[model samples]
Target chain A: MASQAAIGFTRGAPSLDIIDTEGLVEATRLAFAEDPAGTTAYGTAVGYAPLRKWIAEQHGVPVEQVLVTNGSMQADAFLFEQLVSPGDAVIVEAPTYDRTLLNLRQRGAEVHPIALHEDGIDVDAVQALLESGVRPKLAHIIPNFQNPAGYTLSAPKRARLLALASQYGFTLFEDDPYFSIRFEGEQLPTMLSQDTSGSVVYASSFSKTVCPGIRVGYLVGPAEVIAGIAKIATTTYISPNMVSQSIVNQFCRSGRLDKSIDTVRAALRQRKDALVAALERELPKAEYTAPQGGYFMWVRLPGVSIDALADAAAEHGVAFVKGADFLLEGGDDSVRLAYSGLSAEEIDEGVTRLAAAVRSLDA
Target chain B: MASQAAIGFTRGAPSLDIIDTEGLVEATRLAFAEDPAGTTAYGTAVGYAPLRKWIAEQHGVPVEQVLVTNGSMQADAFLFEQLVSPGDAVIVEAPTYDRTLLNLRQRGAEVHPIALHEDGIDVDAVQALLESGVRPKLAHIIPNFQNPAGYTLSAPKRARLLALASQYGFTLFEDDPYFSIRFEGEQLPTMLSQDTSGSVVYASSFSKTVCPGIRVGYLVGPAEVIAGIAKIATTTYISPNMVSQSIVNQFCRSGRLDKSIDTVRAALRQRKDALVAALERELPKAEYTAPQGGYFMWVRLPGVSIDALADAAAEHGVAFVKGADFLLEGGDDSVRLAYSGLSAEEIDEGVTRLAAAVRSLDA
Candidate 1:
């Protein structure tokens, strides 16, 4: 077989320039030097205290409400395991995060996806679904610049979503990994901030901001919900790695997190601009959203078959995710390209190739 | 108000050391240096390829058979989630890992613990249980230096155990984190190596050997079992963090793994000796086994109530695990002391305090 090609525009990982490798190294070295025995020994279950405290302060949530997880992904899985049984009904936004969709599917939950408009998830559609006796056990949303769709829920939509959750008696899972890296637009309040009935379980991660390799993410919810997730976590990995936790805790405490996020936001913004410009100039006929913050752009290649476009792109040594991958129902003719990791120049070239691929595809 | 004592051992978690801060920093650095774009991006579900290759080589298993997990605890949890359901019967060694017990209990499985003897799990008991119409869906065992019990199945018993598994339709789960840390005795062959029925899901971890902070571990088994676990893992964490995996792969490949193990083993051996010596000098009436490897020493303190003993030890500023924590039945008088994390001097002091507590209970 010919050498397998491995290039893709379909990842949610952070960029290296934003990762603060030197800072992490220094922090780790300091952690070890400061306390080798502490680093090697056992740690707390909820998380390292300092890290938990820092996260609690950062998110404006109580430390008791937070539980550090292996990653935000684990946080999501743990919550679902506790909340959703096989065949349980879970709601989602159409073209949501693929992994979350897959997670619910794997759990044997019947997922109900509401249409996502350019502004965000259609609140009225969600209300209608809940009213139709769906009574979902959970609704998974990426309120801050969603994956694949790259659309942020407006402030009013956030409030309405939470209100609907309370009325319908379903839990709201707001996954906001890209909450801090917006390239433009006024920051919209998160579902957690707007939650009035304590129905929202908020998850965020250092992975998108600092490093994914550390596998340190956390969950914030009502104490009982946090406890339930903790039970799942206890059986799973027991706890996140304390060595990484402690060092990250130290880094955050030392005021490194702010600096790192600043550097990351600037780099991601430049790259996002490059990708957006390329999409506009080369594929001007295509419809897509430019995200205010976060890493991705969702392009609607109207009339073009996504499969044909993907195949054509692969031939040109470019690979991106098709809309079908993100949908609860497949066969959508859209594409998502992440412009975070690649440099501006590569972003232009990759999108140029993608534009060519879409143009070549049959309508 | 005097500070209320933390109601539980709320702060102690041995699982946190798997994250490896120094390794993570270096991994992050190298990840950026080698593939700057890849570090911040999403990784393959199969894990970082080098890490999988390293783990496979370390275990003498094929790469196809090994799947990296956040921790061995997660490996066990995922396996159970995939294989067993409510009311399913699972065979476990009596007085097993508490987390294993909890995982099974949470799943609402009927747990049947085969009583363990010094020679290891009572093969006769296991065989009898298998024959007794339990029809267990899974059999969870720690064939190499088991947790809590500190028993390694004798050579003959190993064969018998494998035979029983083959005869029974149950899948065997071999958790062997402590296999390589043997301070004395010839290393026994692993159950995975002896397994013939393709029924064994062999799990191991770097926590006991290196550190627990990074939450890195792996499982080797038939591809189907692994696939199922992968599905559970996918739902749980989307994917294990790539940063730590890359770092560990680099560390292992650099020949530092052996050196690290040597360093840890030396310290663990000294600590073990300290406890064994303390037991001989002070708690002379107690019955205990000299562990061949791993951190724990299982002691059955004579004529002292385990609860009283634990209470007294804690009062004296020494902490030990109560035996009841590790039992399905009949370990009310036993206790487990992990001396590895403490220094030789601390082990001496801690055991002495424990001995005094035991004496005072009788007084």
Candidate 2:
């Protein structure tokens, strides 16, 4: 097994071919040339002002509503630190991003998992939980092309979620990192865009679009919440990386970001298509959601053990994440395939290999 | 009061002239050219491997003992999250960096302030507190050019502090961001270097030497403790900014970092000298320690209230940090003058104006 090294289908990263190295270099150079002192000095706790202002302008919100962070994950940590108390109830998706669940657990929050369906999280289940008398501190949702599950929350569900938050007074943390990567569907309004009661804390990251290494993300919420988060940020980290933010500001201001996103979208669309086609042909019985924009495809192999399949897949030189890793409850029959990093050819071949592993598990 | 503008002498920042803008631009370009994919991809939670290796190699420690962070403050936050349980007894400098004190207080730690002297922290006070049956979970110390005090801990005191940590079974956190900026002192070994019982966690930042905008810092401690910190970092931030870390790696690897440090040292030394000379000439009654290096000079004005002096200083177009801001207890007669960001002429003039403010307060 060790001799036949596995081809990774588990990493959720943007394709290398789409990365605009020259554009990034140019932006970085311009940032240094224009404001070396400001770029290298201690920045404000919220973020670099130009970048924050630019993000605000893009979102059609005031600058005070947005706080730029190291990444969306930092925003999550800050919000959790600010909101969660021991034994406080919090709602999470059943097959959520494992790291978020881990963070909530570490904060001593009593996490209640809500099932996620094809359209999005089961809003009815959430409403039922709320009505049943669990007063949650927050409801964390990945609204678009959700990680692991690869299901975007429906527009109607987004509205219901917001209304529920407003009625129940629980904060709704909308984690929408992959919202802009839509390949074929009409873009839905963000939970935040529709939110008026100041109940939504919307977080998005440039990791999927610009570059993860730059480590830039932003959170838009109520001004007071943003201020509180900024205070926590002051103690946690003095500020975000100003060099990266400044370069990003330059890239964004130069209008290269949209072009870069187009490049990424085209490349990822091709890879996602290739993986979907391969999975249909190779593993006819496999059940999965076809994600519109994000990096993942969630496949459920009925009557097959995920642990056995994962081991067999590794032996066959194809690797993916077992769905159990993403869930707090049952996921013994599922797996998550990330097609973002691999080429179309690699995706096809990897799926074919994965099929062989499934057959081996059946044997 | 609003009409009286202030000339800021409160900022603890490096002079803009000393920042190597061209060198940083070159490094950033080189980073993109050399490793675009790695630089832009998801990095390990601890940090970029080469940067961590370089930091460890520089400190003469195993790489496992090092955990790279977003900044030194993030390192502080991670350590606090790991060690400080609610109501844990913790020892801090009397006049410590206010943010660290704030962070500890927020974590619900019962903080005991040990007095700081010209040579170092008052070790006798620390010993007395320990002997009085207060078991601190950690003792936080700024060993080199302590913030707002500009005092370096003596080598003998450093040894004693480590011994105390080992004897008391409490971790010693040596915060040493300004160690490399010393202009004229015999360099003392770090507490981590002297500790054999795995009782010291030494944190330092490249913010002062290379650039703060890159936001790179590291902690060298017991490998287990570092691993724990890395785990917390995994939750707080997936990783530090890899793009900045890569550029910094290029800067350090190319042998430009030492040169940059030299530039900062020369600039700060001249500014420090100018401020000292100005103080001697303009305010003969002001008592202060002439620091060998670092950004700040602590001054005590006998019979003058800091609040009144600060108000007068603003009216005279000179502003400094009132010492009350730094201390947990009394500092109403003191102030901290930061000379790092100003030119020599600016420092001289600023001090003269501050003297006028003192006289105004007297009148």
Candidate 3:
């Protein structure tokens, strides 16, 4: 099933063009000069400290609160492993990140979906679920331009969501991998930045801004939760790749991270704009959310079956994630079109093909 | 405790010196060109196909049986998480890798320790443990020159160990990170290579041979086990870093992997000899096992507490892992010193310090 997904899409990843091999060589050289033996050996489970400290400082959280991981995905997995056990109820946003939903479901969590609106996941729906005795172990939200959906949680809802979380007694998993990828909209305060009850377990990643070739991300929560995750980390990867972590730390510390982020932000915004505009011109009838940040656009094709659209689109020289793939298969009518890793011409071409596919589905 | 460990080891990695940054750059560049989007974006859970294929080909396993992971540590953790639930019976060799032991114990497993002999784990003792009503869920072993103990499981004993596992209905976790690092000894067939029962969940790494800084490793096992681990990997890091995985795959495919292994083997053997000779000259009273392969030497100080020795050595600007750290705390009088990371002069000076520390403990 996953292999088929790979065969389908023409992905756009700017980081590929941006990965500084010269920098890695320089870092590797510096790293070897300092500790040749330690490089090949195991590292700390909490991640490289300087990197952790940098992340904490970046987020305005205490250093102890930040924990490094292989990627934000790993961080999410750690949160689930530490908090959500088998048979536990998880409150997830519908049309959410497919992988996050899959992780929770695979772990045997009784996943209950809270509908996502244009702004983000509905607070009232979550409240209703909480009141109806779902007793969700966690509420996983990608408040900042959520994957695929590209829907940032509104500021008004953020406070209410926190309140609901406090009242409901379920931890909130704020996965904001694309937090810094904002191109057009005002940045909302993070759910974690406002969280007061210690009910938020936050995850972020450098895959978007820096480089994904190394797979370095982080998890932040209470110390106990972080400790549990650390135990998991120890058992799992021993410590994350210290070499990559150290390189990233150096990259960020040396001010290269800021420049890289600027590069990614401008490129992504241009790519996102081109894709959105192309889709509008080519298929205005197809309903899709206009994204402020991030790489994906959740498209709802009214009167067109997503599976059929996906099949047709692929046949027409364009490929995208069928909405049903994001849902429990055979459960939803949404299709996720990721424009994050495409060139302007490719995006236009892909959307044009998608438009043709959509029209064919209606016919 | 973990913080202290991370702090004490502040030097650069040795394997980084061996890494061909130019080759790596070329590989990364090629990989990015092919899957520019895949390398930066979220990828399949099982791992990148090229890397997985290479790993499968290397292990002589089917492609379906291989999983590329962040590192072997993650593979170990994933297997433990999937196979050993809380209070699950796990059989481990006493004086095993401390991190692996910690991984299982922290997961609430009833860890049954089998004594280690020079040849391998005491199969008779393991059989006795198996017979004594502890139905073991898993038997984890380092079949090559293992951590701390640095003892290879003998060929005859390997069959006996597998037989015991079969008789007892337990899975064998064959960790062989050091398998290809052999210098002086004859290369033994791995448990996975010889297994007919489809039982061994094998793990290995490029850290020892290429450079651990990149943190690329793999796990090979039955399809069901690999599937289960894949679910965990999906949640953990979604997938391994595609760039790293692809680069390593390319490097391996180019046939440099064998040459790289040979380089590491020669370097480690030289360091091991230097350490051994230093021990002979400086601390003749300390009974030490000369490792035939891999990076560690197990030194036992009779009538002197290894903890005291470690502390005294630390004071004198040298450090070694106390045996107690490897086993459950409050272990036997042994210390594990790794020579792979340090220079020959450092090894000699460190051992000389260790000798003085032993004298100080006696005094």
lDDT of 3 by residue, A209-297 (tens): 77766688898887778888887776676678776677677777767778777777787778778877987898787777778888788
lDDT (tens digit, per residue) of candidate 3 on B10-99? 122453555555555555556555665555455677877877877788777788898888878777877887899998989888888877
lDDT of 1 by residue, A11-87 (tens): 77765666787777667667766765556555556777778888888768888899987778877878888899998
Q: The CA-based lDDT of model 1 is what?
A: 0.77
Greater TM-score among 1 and 3 belongs to 1
Say which candidate scores most in TM-score: 2
| Model 2 per-residue lDDT tens digits across residues B1-363 | 446556678988886788898999999888988888778888988898989999999888899999888889888889999999999999999798989999999889999998999989999999999999999999999988889899889988988888889999999999989999999878888887788999999999888998887889889998999998888888778888999999999999998999999999999889889988998899889898888888998899899898888777878898889899888889989999998889998888788888888888767
TM-score of each: 0.91, 0.98, 0.85
Where is model 2 more than 4 Å wrong at Cα? B1-5
Tens-digit per-residue lDDT, A1-363, candidate 2: 557656788888886788898999999988988878778999988999899999999889999999999988998888898999889999999899999999998889999999999999999999999999999999999998899988999999999999999999999999999988888788999999999899999999889889888899989999999999998888778888899999999999888899998998999889889988998899999998799998998999999998888778878999999899988989999998999999998888888888988888767
The 10-residue segment with the lowest total lDDT in model 3 chain B? B1-10
lDDT of 1 at A44: 53
Tens-digit per-residue lDDT, B196-314, candidate 1: 78878888877765677656788899887887777667666777866666656666766656766777667767867888898899878889888877767788876678877777767
